[model samples]
Target: MRLSIRSWVKRVTITGSILAISLVSIGCFYEQAARSRAIKDFPAPGKLVDIGGRQIHLNCQGRGTPLVVLEAGADTSGSALWQPVQEQVARFTRVCSYDRAGIMWSDPAKGQRNSHAIAEDLHKVLRAANEQPPYILAGASMGGPYVMTFTKYYRKEVAGMVLVDASHPDQTARLAQATGEPASNPIPMAFRALAAVAWTGLPRLVLPDAEVPELPSQTAKAITAYQPTSLAAAFAEAAVFEDSLREAGTFRTLGHLPLAVLSRGKPWSAFSEAERAAGGLTREQFNRAEAAWANMQAEEAGWSSNSTHQVLADSSHVMQLERPDAVIAAIRDVVVRATRANATP
Candidate 1:
């Protein structure tokens, strides 16, 4: 059959769309089955507290005052990210970690996923769980701002804070100006593609988040199992990351509050080889980024007069996991200082 080129192109387009639809259906089925299996295999370790109509996962341990509330960063396995830290901190004082809505076992949340919204949800979960105040908050990455927002709202309740390689509110603008590159995800297109097919469960096979070797064995297992299911939620949070930063930016300062700003010394580790290749980021650009990051961390430390700023010389962004000793020391230091202040009065 001698078909016109226009007709042939039209047919190909229709056929391609049909094939895409079929693939999406198959992917959806695969995704649902995988989700079922995953839920069965890895149930929520903590109890689900009813925060209004929806419930969020909250895990608390130990038995003492000045509770340590840990907030995990963007695209992380929420509470599992703090297992190692929580375990140790729990020995001396009460510590808790929870998944934000739509992350891990928590109920799906609605509205803008900004830091303020996240902090509000955490407050609800804490109240629902009967977890009292006098909290020492430890937030890592985006979690830094989440905890900061919490401190802002519950000022009197907060005892201290620990920012673990925390995100700076102005880093996006500052880094862009510093490096001559727009602030962006390491691989935006790739992430978007994965996010698109995330429901079809293709990324689950392609980007299997197995054991995070840097973390403890048990913690790694929990994160591995929960992570695959939370990819969409993680990316969703990443999408609104700038909003979260801006919301956290409103936090004027911690005053003379006991605070610890733990910055990563090995900033280059944050920009991976793949990231450099994908973004065409050069050594000079990365060096500029590191310089900006160091300066930003110093500024974050200045948020408090009674604050200690330390750069973990051997650590990366996930310094809590890479250098747990340093993270533990920082959190414990804040906790100790906070406790002393409380005792003095």
Candidate 2:
């Protein structure tokens, strides 16, 4: 009986070892395959300019005065995220969108991935690409802080600004109070887990098509294939969310800059039904929370002396994708105002 038990234990141990080895090998293979496929299938559609010994991808379309610069949300590939809106804005004036460092086709850089760092990189990219200033800077979500930082530091170069359902520095704390949950970010943890298995191509298998439903078919595929890099970049940014928020707070006002704050009209749907029920939150409670959120958005518009706050009645958080016309109109309004102002003196 003792001899038989010993043999069974040895067999089980060997099986486990082989299984672990096989999984690791498979992960490595998928990682390489995904990387290769991404390169071949989705080569950078824009010019890759070298900035500070690292390359950043910049895609420019259209031609006119008062150039429009699109800054995408955190972890998003700016060039891709601005696709639908970029094309429309190009019809009126020159518009450019770029990938931040370590995202999409941009080369990775080492440092604290805060809004200041991102804004600095953007300034360099614009200068290197010869996309001169007096730019109409438009940002969405986390991009809001970045453009705000840029506007603060390079005020003279900016003519106007647009915030598309932009993030606020007080968001985390407000959300916690609204939801009665602790203030913490689960996104970085989620990204870390995804990165761990990204080598296995699990992201491609599990990620929903709806995640980037607005992207072109090929671009969407490229994004899916490049999940590992995306997740890593996202993780880096999310890890310093609080720090970025604090930095963004310093840029308190827009001071007569033509600013358009496009707030989402839809209800916040980030919370799960189970969570709502568990919290004993009634419809009235939810509505109140949403009202507070909208109030906060309105407060952002108040930061600028010459700003207009518009709630996009038919749009979600990603107003650029869901309601490109609204975004375009906002940009056009800012441009027209800026042009008239420039003509004044």
Candidate 3:
């Protein structure tokens, strides 16, 4: 059941706060020209396949069965951000990482940026790229829900799964309960404002170069160049975050599928005194949220009858960057298990 692009993006909304704009900026045309030059200078490391009318960047490498698909966090982070993890996964099995709509080298989204559209774009891109499945999905952070939505719609094509400190459908409510109030999430508003002025080179003027020291030097350099220009994709995903979470919430069970749920050991919101003051989140509140998050991860393991849960005590929310070894081992384990299951007549 393919959804038309029109229905896929019925309504577009970016109702949120902003990071106060200052008019010290270049003209849109100048910034666009510079953006184009930046894109050319740091060319896409993968092929851009036409998914529907829009193009999506897909980086595929290595060769083996049960192809691994890497879904990045729905932020300015793109397929290239999975440098360390993908490199190792490629050694054992075929793997592909892609930039979602309006991200990196990919075209802007055609419609609503919910999980359904997100999953379909991936499906279309995979079809266009002729990447066969029985796919092994490894989703980190928000990528977890995107993975679930994919499995919800295309369960047969999925052989195994890994959720790395993934979001829970009830995370908003759960965390709100822990913190004693609903979160007035500032990330969306900040991204929305950033996107509005990114074309005018505001991001380049005020934003610092991306700091991803975990990635190789060249990959890190590419992120610095792309960060200022990719706010459109970041904002697009941020705007519909709740919608995506709700959509994924419905996909609760994975039945007999092989699964691995990895959660970070440290508190995701371990803010400093000043940072905590800004968000009105105290250290005690942060601790409660962390505990809630751990409970949620334990529950996620039950989604599949055959599953394993690992707590990477030294890792944080960005486990892919902080603990690529564990991430790779989990994927490889799932792939091996999926293969063994498939072979069982």
Candidate 4:
């Protein structure tokens, strides 16, 4: 039977649609595989806490008063970001760090991605895990705001706070503007999509330098195995909740609480002009100018009303990873203050 021109056109359209769908499906399949590989490569947390319907992966070591809870940044970072400082602090008091919902082994369950929601989830995690209250909350980069918002609403439960390169409202606004979004949108979904693609695909294609900081051998193997679920959840959370925290008034209720701000001091213009010629600021984009702006605003928050601000000049954004001594000192300082406050006449 001979086919009419109209029928041929329909046949071609259907074929194209099928091909497009197949490609997308294949891409997703590869993404899942890569994620599985990444997760299988990393280290597992010390324990798990069930909160808001999800099980959060966490590691806690040492024992002492004034419990310290460390929050990781937005990307795929977990407690691993504190590798530099973890052991050292573990010597002093009980130090706990965990992967947030949709990252690592933390199941993204039962909450929105807003700052307030994330903060509340942390609270629930602490309570469910039986972590004693009057605790000190410390978060770096995106985590800064997470803990700050937590303290804002759960002031009575908190003992103190440590904001390290936390996200500042003004800085977030600038980034949103730079990426062409209304300042109102906190987590820039468009930018996050691009970042997700880069983190997921580029590393495999480019093959990182062997000298690049690598996870420990066993840890690396575990992370690689757990890749699929971890990456998928992380990407999903970044797309939804990261910017969700930026919605106006999400953190309007900050209360007066003891706080410390650790600002990274890597200068943007310090990169050799030659390096600048290569690309964007190398020393510290997120932790330098942008982080400074955010930390400053956080300093203005009621929590920082009588706080100590420390500029970590020798460190990068990952102060915990790069300068554990400084991070430890900062945490210790806060612990001392809290101790003194409790003993006041």
Instruction: Give the TM-scores of the predictions, in the order they appear.
Output: 0.89, 0.90, 0.89, 0.73
TM-score of 1: 0.89
Indicate which candidate wins on TM-score: 2
lDDT at 77, model 4 = 51
lDDT of each: 0.84, 0.83, 0.86, 0.66
Better of 1 and 2 by TM-score: 2
RMSD of 3: 10.9
Task: Pick the lDDT winner.
Answer: 3
Candidate 1 lDDT over residue span 11-98, tens digit each:
9999999999998899889888888887787788889999889989999999998999999988757887677788888888899989
- Runs with alpha carbons beyond 4 Å of true place in candidate 3: 1-26, 186-190, 267-278
**Local error of candidate 3 at 50, Å?**
0.5
What's the residue-level lDDT of 54 in candidate 3?
Answer: 76
Candidate 3, residues 144-202: lDDT per residue as tens digits? 99999999999999999999999998888899999997777636566678778777777
How do the candidates rank by TM-score, highest first? 2, 3, 1, 4
Question: Candidate 1 has which clashing residue pairs, if any?
Answer: none
lDDT of 2 at 266: 70
Q: Which ten residues in a row have the lowest lDDT in candidate 2?
A: 181-190
CA shift of 74, model 3, Å: 1.9
Q: Model 1: runs farther than 4 Å from truth?
A: 1-23, 185-187, 216-222, 267-279
Candidate 2 clashes between residue pairs 3 or more apart in a chain or in different chains: none
* lDDT of residue 260 for candidate 3: 97
